[model samples]
Target: EAGVVQSPRYKIIEKKQPVAFWCNPISGHNTLYWYLQNLGQGPELLIRYENEEAVDDSQLPKDRFSAERLKGVDSTLKIQPAELGDSAVYLCASSLEGFSANEQFFGPGTRLTVL
Candidate 1:
């Protein structure tokens, strides 16, 4: 089964410009997550989805960030009017269940560079 897929492994954009990233989870997996990782920092949960339902998204910056998992499969994360602080690795992960310990798998991630 496909593990996970992300595009444009790296991105460089000016501050205040909008940016978007995409992810495709493992086939048959039901749980998906989005995380932000800063240099020397652990991945921080941005959002999580169990199939089509967004189970958790408390950490997401509602003022500038948005995400979607349409049809409960592929997902997209967008940051509008990006800020310099938004420069970080945006990771996408998937798991068999939202609470499964050994189910989580991470993608290569998209590193956004805000200028």
Candidate 2:
């Protein structure tokens, strides 16, 4: 019955330094997701995993961003050589299934600020 967990909760980095965020999904959930939310905007899916398989990651920025859910329970998102535009909330959410109508529970998020 544990909720999602994230680290640091906040970050400040220069424009070219790398940063990483972590997440642990709810127990017994099969679907995990990473989302990005710019200030004043809704979350946008960066990737989605269904039991260790990355079912959807079309929105992920391949050039400098990457993610993985090796055991399908925990996940990590990395932004290498970060950019000023990368400053935003990196949210992790989980659901029972990939297409479930149920609402996803979100983590507090790692707020990254680039200077």
Candidate 3:
């Protein structure tokens, strides 16, 4: 079975540039999540989706960050005019339905570097 897939494992851009990251969750998984991780810190949930509905997104920066889960399968995260402080890893994770206690499977995150 294929795990989650993410694009552009590494990205470099100047400050105030827009960057987008993509993710494809595992087949049969109904819960998906996006997280942001700073250097030397654990991942912080940015958004969570159960199917096409965004269940939680309070931590997401609405001013510059946006996310979407299309058809309950693939997802995209975008940061417009990214700041120098936005340099971090964007992680995508997925798990089974019914809020299973099993560990979530994470993708090889997209690392963004803002200069």
Candidate 4:
């Protein structure tokens, strides 16, 4: 039983450039989530998915960001024309379900730096 997996542990891009992150949740997990954390701030949920359906994404910035969970297994998050303010760590997590009691497994996270 592997835990969640994320790609590109670190990324450095100039402001206004496009960048993307990827994640592969644990086997049999039905819930997936994307989060962002600033240097001194805790992670904030950017989006959540129940299987292949997006259950919550109010916190996601639709203007230059987008996400998708394909086949309820793997997911991708993209930031287009990323701004300097977007520099942060992008995290991916997963759990068996959306229940609060279900412990979520987090990946190492992709650290993005927009300069």
Candidate 2 lDDT for residue 59: 99
Put down candidate 1 lDDT per residue, 1-115, tens digits, no spaces.
6779998799999999999999999998899999999999999999999998898999999999999999999999999999999999999999887365756899999999999
| Clashing residue pairs in candidate 1 (N, C-alpha, C atoms within 3 angstroms) | none
Q: List the global CA lDDT of all models.
A: 0.94, 0.93, 0.94, 0.95
Residue 81 local lDDT, model 2 = 87
TM-score for candidate 2, please give it.
0.96
User: What are the per-residue Cα lDDT tens digits for candidate 2 across 20-81?
Assistant: 99999999889999999999999999999998999999999999999999977999999998
Model 4: per-residue Cα lDDT over 32-65, one tens digit each: 9999999999999999999999999999999999
TM-score of each: 0.96, 0.96, 0.96, 0.97
C-alpha lDDT (0 to 100) for residue 3 of candidate 2? 94
lDDT of 1: 0.94
- Model 4 clash pairs are none
lDDT, ranked from best to worst = 4, 3, 1, 2
- In model 1, state the lDDT of residue 104: 83
> Which stretches of model 3 miss by more than 4 angstroms?
none
C-alpha displacement of 66 in model 2, angstroms?
0.3
Worst 10 residues of 4 by lDDT: 96-105
- Residue 29 local lDDT, model 1: 83
What TM-score, to 2 decimals, does candidate 4 have?
A: 0.97
